[model samples]
Target: MIAWMMLAQAALLGLLGAGVTVAGIAKVRMNDWILGAAAIATLTLVVQIVASIIAPFTGSGPTGDPFEYWVYLVMAVLIPPAVALWALIDKGRWGVVALGVALMSVGVMVYRMHQIWFVQVF
Candidate 1:
């Protein structure tokens, strides 16, 4: 749970969410951008997971409770891909809606990751 990485993820998710919202509102089905964002989010999540795995052994063990962090990580890694795949298959505005939800979820997960790493409360 690197602080900088979490922050970066948060920023990316925030931007993605905003983009999705705007595109949805404008009734513009920008599948390319949505797909690109999903791909980037997945990559970022993978990097974060790898970093978390190596953190403990690299002398930065247990920044907070592992259980809490794992919950956030798992959700962050799973939700976007599921939504993206669903969106690709569902040929309607529902796809955009699903992508929008996924982007927002990623933003929330970023915050949860930050809390798990830095807040030291939950």
Candidate 2:
């Protein structure tokens, strides 16, 4: 990932994380605002697809096994939509918690993917 991509990913993680955490803590139902977050996350995943395709040429690509990075990528791509779908199916505080968990999980996954991408450097 490049600098902008990293920053964007971090922003998404923070957005999703904070949004979910607050909603979960406040016991709010799944709402349109959060669905907007999911849409942006989907857009991010689209960016990820483009980034992965070009990363190797830029020499900013993963230095370790690309597979590891890809696995995290898959999860990162899946998370928001999956959580939204699940929350829709099971609505409650638990649903909000599920969103929170998913967002937090994305944070961890992104960090791990960063490690996987740069492992050979450090």
Candidate 3:
């Protein structure tokens, strides 16, 4: 895993979480800005997933268990879209909270992914 890429993902994901949470607290619902942020974060995550998959073939991979890494990545890719859909359907403050939680989960998962990539076993 590239250091810069890992950091960028974490930062962007963190921003996504913060943005969604703030929107929730303010009782805002679906909007172009919210959708755009989610799109960017989701696109980045999909790109990262592809990169990780190819990394192994390119003689690069996580030091930790591959199965665990892939499972997390796949779930991360799925979550944002799911929550976004739910937000669109609900169209309320609770939907915003759900989006915030989903984005935060993605942020935490991305951090864990970086840890998995760089683990040092004795």
Candidate 4:
């Protein structure tokens, strides 16, 4: 629930999302950099999950109510892996497009995490 950490994650996700989009638009094939970006986003989500688990004990409160936290957790944990798996099933630009979508989702999740941790309402 650290404000700075959430902001940093959001910014990183935004940049990664933009990168993915540009790479896909340029007709770039699957590459290590794209995979690395996905990996980094996955790691960031994992860190967020861990932070959420420990937040209450550390006095970060309930993360703006229970329902919101659960929603965020579910999406954050599930989306990236699902997208990556689906993308890997094919070897084309659409795969990169899927990754772009996944990256965008991560950016949204980052913002949602920030809201759930700091905002007063859903």
Candidate 5:
């Protein structure tokens, strides 16, 4: 995985989490803005998947186990949509908070994946 792209993905997710958290604190229900942000985050993960596929060919392959990195990537890709679905179903302020929390979790996951790809030893 490319360092810049990984950092961008984490930053995007962090911002998305903060925005959703603020909306939740204001007691706003799930709305287009939240859903749209989630969609955008999900799409970025898709882009990350594509980047991962191409990165090794360009000589930026993982320093750690490829299987582990891929598992993290696949799981990270699922989070935003899952949280979006949760928000849709719940239609409550807490659901928005949950979405925010999930986004933050995915951000952490992305960082972990970055470590697995480029920073890990042994």
Candidate 6:
């Protein structure tokens, strides 16, 4: 995994999480911003999937357990859509907050995956 790309993804997730959380706090419902953020986040993770696929060809591989990294990747990729669906179904303020929390959680997970890829070599 590329360190810079991981950092960029983390930054994006952090910003999106904060934005969604603030919107939720302001009593926002399931709107374009929230949905759009979710969509963007999901698409970025899909990009990560592609990057992971190409990493081996580029001579970059996780330093840590590949299984663990993959599990984190898969889980992080799943969160946005799941939360977005929940928000859409509930259409409630707390649902928005939940989506925000999920985004933040995925951010943290991505950071951890970065650590796994770059820091935990053994």
The pairs that clash in candidate 2 are: none
lDDT (C-alpha, whole model) for all candidates? 0.79, 0.77, 0.84, 0.78, 0.89, 0.91
lDDT string, candidate 3, 1-122, tens digits = 67579778988888888888899889997887787777887899988987897888887777888888888888989999889888888999888878887888898899888888877832
Ranking of all predicted structures according to lDDT, beginning with the best and ending with the worst: 6, 5, 3, 1, 4, 2
The per-residue C-alpha lDDT of model 3 at residue 40 equals: 80
Q: Point out the worst 10-residue segment of candidate 1 by lDDT.
A: 113-122
Tens-place lDDT per residue, model 1, 1-122, is 57777788888887887787667667767478878888888888889889889988877766667888888888888988888888788856768777877887888887877876766444
Q: Which segments of model 2 are wrong by more than 4 Å?
A: none
- What's the CA error at residue 11 for candidate 5, in Å? 1.2
Each model's backbone clash number: 0, 0, 0, 0, 0, 0
Candidate 2, residues 1-115: lDDT per residue as tens digits?
A: 7645755686677678787878877988878876677777767776876888798897777787998789888878898888889888887877877877777677667767777
Query: Where is model 5 more than 4 Å wrong at Cα?
Result: 120-122
- For candidate 5, the clash count comes to 0
Q: Which stretches of candidate 3 lie over 4 Å from their true place?
A: none
Give model 5's TM-score versus the native structure.
0.94
Which residue pairs in model 3 clash with each other?
Answer: none
Deviation in Å, model 5, residue 109 alpha carbon = 0.7
Residue 116 error for model 4, in Å?
Answer: 1.9
lDDT of 4 by residue, 1-122 (tens): 66788789888988887888788888886787888888888898888777777877887676366687778877877777777777677767778777887788778787876886777634
State the lDDT of candidate 6 residue by residue for 21-75, as single tens digits.
9999899998998999999999989999899989978899877888999999999
Q: Judging by TM-score against the true structure, name the best candidate.
A: 6
Worst window of 10 by summed lDDT in candidate 4: 113-122
TM-score of each: 0.88, 0.86, 0.92, 0.89, 0.94, 0.96
Judging by lDDT against the true structure, name the best candidate.
6
lDDT of 2: 0.77
